[model samples]
Target chain A: MIFKIAWRNIWRSKLRSFTVMGSVIIGVWSLSFMLAFFAGFIEAYVSSAIENDLSHIQLHHPDFKKDKEVQYRLKDIEAIEKQVTSLDAVKAYTVRSLNNGMLATATGSRGVQIRGVLPEKEAAITNLDQKITTGVYFDATQKRNPILVSKRLAEKLNLSLKSKVVLTFQQANGALTSAAFKIIGLYQTGNAIFENLNVYIRQEDLSRLMGETAMIHELALLLNKKDAIEATQHYLSQHNDSTQVLVENYQQISPDVNLYESQMSVATYIMIVIIMLALIFGIINTMLMAVLERTRELGMLMAVGMNRSKVFLMIILETILLGVIAAPIGLVLGFLTNAYFGSYGIDLSSYSEGMEKFGLSDVVYTHMQTADYLLIMIAVAITAILGALYPAFKAIRLKPVEAIRKI
Target chain B: MKEVIKVQAIKKTYNAESIPVHALRGVDLSIQQGEFTALVGPSGSGKTTLLNIIGGLDAATEGSVLIDQQNISQLTDSQLIDFRKEHIGFVFQAYNLIPVLTAKENVEFVMLLQGKSQAERDARVKDLLGAVGLSEQIDRRPNQLSGGQQQRVAVARALASKPKFVLADEPTANLDSKSTADLLDIMAKLNREENITFLFSTHDQRVIDRAQRIVTLEDGAIISDEQNAIGS
Candidate 1:
């Protein structure tokens, strides 16, 4: 009977009911789109940062991180590889000597961070070879002094394939050294900053050039599970001793990506609050009008022995039912919106540059969240119930005889 | 005869600007079960005020109303609602029916408040609609029905809960003479056939002529209390 009465009461004033629901739908739609896009943008940043900038984790000689010199290499290279590979969690690790070297071309010359890498292992950590826009990757076992540079670096050097580039750096024995390499390939992963600064060379050739045998500065490890990145790092940090360890992650090495994630979280919460506020006012106004329109009916209910509390609760239940019906629809709309945007990403280039000023990537994408949808459902339901309070109180506390008389 | 309503020195006052406006000045009255009583006077004559005080809708300033031996004034808000729900029914002049409810649903409203079962609600609501001669208009909303039909629905609603007493305050004020007489006749039949008490506060001449018992008030006090008709 309460349900039947409440159902009829909703339709008693169609315009008012429609207004309330319309506001909710709009609020849900707006928040869904905003939060989803922000989520997408942040996820894109984290994945891209991890894939290109940092793998799961990187291991360095404790002092090597400070000075970044080949002389600070760990004593046993093969043993560290064996232990890390046996962990079951470790997918692959690339041993590389990463330090500054001077490169000279016919067009120009500049100092750059020259990375010495094994071709196969290096490919998994950095996608630079895969991003080759011209020529090809250097062969790992070919015993050739060939190197790959970014398109931005190539542009700076004004050089093409087969261009002989000279790289010079101090050796582990404190000896000045230089190596001439044939320019094998040029790559561009769309990041102009990285493309302009980095050069890749053969690991064996650079090891001989550094005057060190079977030694590298750091090992960058890649793992399959992303959530286990910290755990993997922790495992290595705990297992390894004797050699000082420097554990670096993209999260710390590049804090911008993490900052982006944090900002998106705050934005998502703000959107929820804004949307809920709109729903709050809408629902409150709706129930107020409902009580006014149904004054005589409520009084009649009270006169018939329905107490004030029951009157209040019944109305709250009505609004809760209203929210319950609308919640799934709102959630589906949000989920579908995220799915749609996830498949076909929005072109935010024009918007991106402006947003980049504030350190936010403008590539608007959908970051779908299961928990967020649930929270939205619970929030909307709460808002609807809260909105019913005033009217419910009025209905139960009214002087039945006088209220009916007024009607 | 058992007394359905016993108003013992019931005084009602309205607080306006914190000063009391005496609405019912020491009202003392009694109506027996199965009796039709008329409280007749002009506007502000304390007729409706005295009726409200007895219906447990408003608390008396001083005194008590014992309906079916229950002191209505002393009951808490919830207790008063329960008391009214089980023992009293009411009819108003305009908008007597819930606008959203059909004629049957409006009658069912009272029965629902009485916690009647579905089967009981359905059977009794149908019978009440027939009793009010609105069987065909049971499914129609109040706006779709004529004033006469709506008033009949209101009367059916009041009687649906099967209360010991009913307070009708200007129930026919908005009705034409035909509808007014129809409503009066239905009340009269329900009073006689069901052995329920019917009390009306009205200034309508038609209502006055039909009442077997009449009580007249001047200002906030009753000036005459008499039974003009001998027919029971």
Candidate 2:
């Protein structure tokens, strides 16, 4: 019966009730969309970093990370490659002979990290073949000493497809060697920083030029499932000698990615709290007006044997019912909005140049976990209850004798 | 006959700290069961104040009120609410039926507070609304009913808990003469049939004419208490 009275009381002022509900609906919908958009933004950034620069895990000669000397090559390259192939979690793996060197074109010269990679293996892991916009992959060219340079780097060095560039670097024997290589492919990964710093050439050409037959400086692995990364890293770490081979996950390789990933949860909670705080004030204002306007009726209720607790409960119930009725509608609307944007994606091509500097993709697909949706609903319920407290307290504070006499 | 209410020299002063205005000054009164009594006075004569004191709606500054042998002045605020719920019913001049509820629900409201079962509440609501001659308007909300009909609903709601007595303050003030007469006829029939005691604070001669006993006050003190042969 208390519930019935409360329900009817809310409808007594239909406009007021709708106004409060409308605010709640808008708050929930906007909050959900904002969270999903941010999640998509972060997802694009982290995934781009992984795909372009850091695979799920990387293995290097322990000293090669601190100093990029060609002498600090893998101790047992064949054994590591065998172990990598045996793991069911490994989707693709590439061995690279990395050298920090200078690439000189006739027009200009720039510092670059020359990555010696097996074309088919590297393509399988990074999908480098699909990213080629103007030139074909290495398999299509019959030229010797073929190279792949990022479109950004090619432009910076005033070189294009079929252009010859000279790469000068240190050999295993401490001799500085320079080789002329022809660029067979130009690719754009939408990561301006990575594109500007690194260039890829065949492992055979790099090894032969470095005065060694098989010089493996880095081994990168991509996993079928991200959840398998930790276990695979642990398994490789257990099998290998830690002193010789340093096995590191993507997060350990790039601390900035880790920071962004860790801060995602905190950022989501902060956004929700900020939005709910605004909604709490709105709900409190509306409920206070409702309570104040019904002063005489509330007094009559108290005089007719309705206790303070029941009166308090009635007001609380009314406030909560408003949220409960509006939250699901907002959730559905938010879901539909997200689903629509997730399918088509939100185009940010106009900001692509600025976004690429931060390693984020231009088109972002909205994404949120099911758990986050549930958490948002719980947040709104708590906001409504918190919003009801002051008004409910004011209601229970009324002196029945005086309230009854109030006009 | 059993004495249903006993007021012992009750005094009520408004704003005692700054400019003391005495609404009730050491007034004492008693009424037995089944008595149709009116506390009559002009403005500022303490009739409503005395009725409020008797109804446990206001506390006296210096005296105690015993209703059916329980000293209500000693009860806590929460206990007083429970006490009033069980023992007192009130009808105000403006007809304070809950506006959101239908006429039948307003009468059933008190019984709901009493934790009465649905069957019990339904039976009593039917009987009481019928007793008030509002059986046909049971489904209508207070706003849908006439002023007279709303007052009748308030009367039915007041008697829903079967209180020791009903306190009515100017119940006929907003009603037409025909509505007032119809309301008085209903109260008189209830008084005669069920022996329910009634106490009223009023300035209307029609109510004074219908009361078996009239207590008139002047300057916060009672000047006369008389029994009328016409009402008896």
Candidate 3:
């Protein structure tokens, strides 16, 4: 009966009820979209890190990680690759010999990490072949040394496709070595930090030039299922000769990616709290007015035998019903907006230059977890209950004799 | 007959700090079961104050009000509300039917508070609304009804809970002559047929003339209490 009365009472002032409900609808919609937008940004950043340089997991000579010396190479690269590849969790793997080198053109020279990679394996792991913007990824027909340089690096060095550059570095015997390589491909990974430092070359050519027949400094692994990354990393760490090799996951390899990943949920909660706090004041104001306008009616209700608790419950129920009615409309609005933007993505090309500085794509696809949607609904419900308390208390505090005369 | 309402030297003072205005001054009154009585007085004579104290709507400053042998003054605020719900029904001068509810729903509201079953509430609402000559107006909200019709709905609501008595304060003050007569006839019939007690505070001569007993007040004190051999 109290529910029936309360339900009917809200309609007595239809415009006021609609106004409060409309605010709730707008609040929920904007909060959801905002959370989704931030989630997309974080997703783009983390995945770009994984795709560009940080594979799901990596292995290196324990000494090579501290000092990039060419002598600290994996002893039996073939055996380690064989063991890791047999595991079903290992989707693809690449072996790389890294050296700190300087790339000098007729214009200038800059320090870079010259990565020695097998073209086919590197393509599968980093998708480097697909990111080429100017030329083919490491042409097999060429007799000269072919290399891949990021578009940003190429532009900095004033080099283009088919341009010749000399890479100067130390050999395995600590002798100075220099090899001239042609830029076969110019690629852009949308990562300013990676673009500024790293360049790719064929492992065979680098090994021959450094006077070593077989050299491997790093092993990068991609997983079939990302959720199994921890299990695979644990397995690889235990299976390998722990005294020589160190296994590190993507997060360990790049701490910035880890920070971006963990902060997504925290950012969502902060957004919800901010939006709900604003909504709380609006709801409190609306409910307070509702209670004040019905002072006489509420007193008569109490005088006719409705207890204080019932009156309090009636007021709370009215506020909750407003949220209950508005939430679905907001959720649907948010869902439709996310759905449309999730598939096609929101174009941010006009700001691509700024976005690339943070390794974010120009087109961001909004993504939200199921748990976040549920959490938002629960948050709105709790917010509605909190907003009702002061107004409900004011309603139950009315003295019947005085309130009845309030006309 | 058992005494349904008893008051002994009940005193009510408002704003007792700077200047005390006594609304009820040592007033003693009693009414037995099944009595249709009127509390009549001129303006500022404390008839409404006495009615409020007896109805448990306001507390007396010095003395206690006992209803059906229970000392209402001794009850806590929550207990007093429950007591009023169980033992007293109110008909306000403004016909304060819950504006959101229809006439039928207004009458059923008290029974809902009592936690009565659906069948009992339905039966009593039909009987009371029919008895008040508002059977045709049951589906109409208070705002849709005339002032007299709204008061009739209030009357039906008052009796729906089958309380010990009905307390009406100027129930007919906003009514025309015909409406007042019609309302008086309904109260008289309900009292005669069902033995329901009624107590009203009024300045209307028509209401005073129809009461079986009349208690008149002067200067916050009851001056006369009389039983009439003839009443409308």
Per-prediction TM-score, chain B alone? 0.95, 0.98, 0.98
Give per-residue CA lDDT, model 2, range B1-232, as digits (tens): 9999999988899999999999988888999999999889999999888887888888899899999888999988889889889989999888988888999999999999999999999999999999999889999999999999999999999999999999999999999999999999999999999998999988889988999999999988889999988883
Model 3, span B18-74: residue lDDT tens: 799988889999999999999999999998888888888899999988898899999
Deviation in Å, model 1, residue A309 alpha carbon: 2.0
Q: lDDT tens digits, residues A339-367, model 2?
A: 99889999999999999998999999999
**CA lDDT, every prediction?**
0.79, 0.92, 0.90
TM-score of each: 0.90, 0.97, 0.97
**Proportion of true contacts reproduced by candidate 1:** 0.82
Residues B125-161 of candidate 1: C-alpha lDDT, one tens digit per residue: 8888898899899999999998988988888888888
Stronger candidate by DockQ (2 vs 3): 3
Cα lDDT tens digits, model 1, A101-182, are 7899877789888888888888877766688889998764445798888876887778888889999887888787988999
Residue clash pairs of candidate 2: none
Q: Which stretches of candidate 1 lie over 4 Å from their true place?
A: A87-89, A101-112, A134-136, A139-147, A152-168, A174-185, A192-197, A228-231, A246-267, A352-365, B16-20, B230-232
| Position A186, candidate 3: lDDT | 91
Model 2 ranges with Cα > 4 A deviation: none
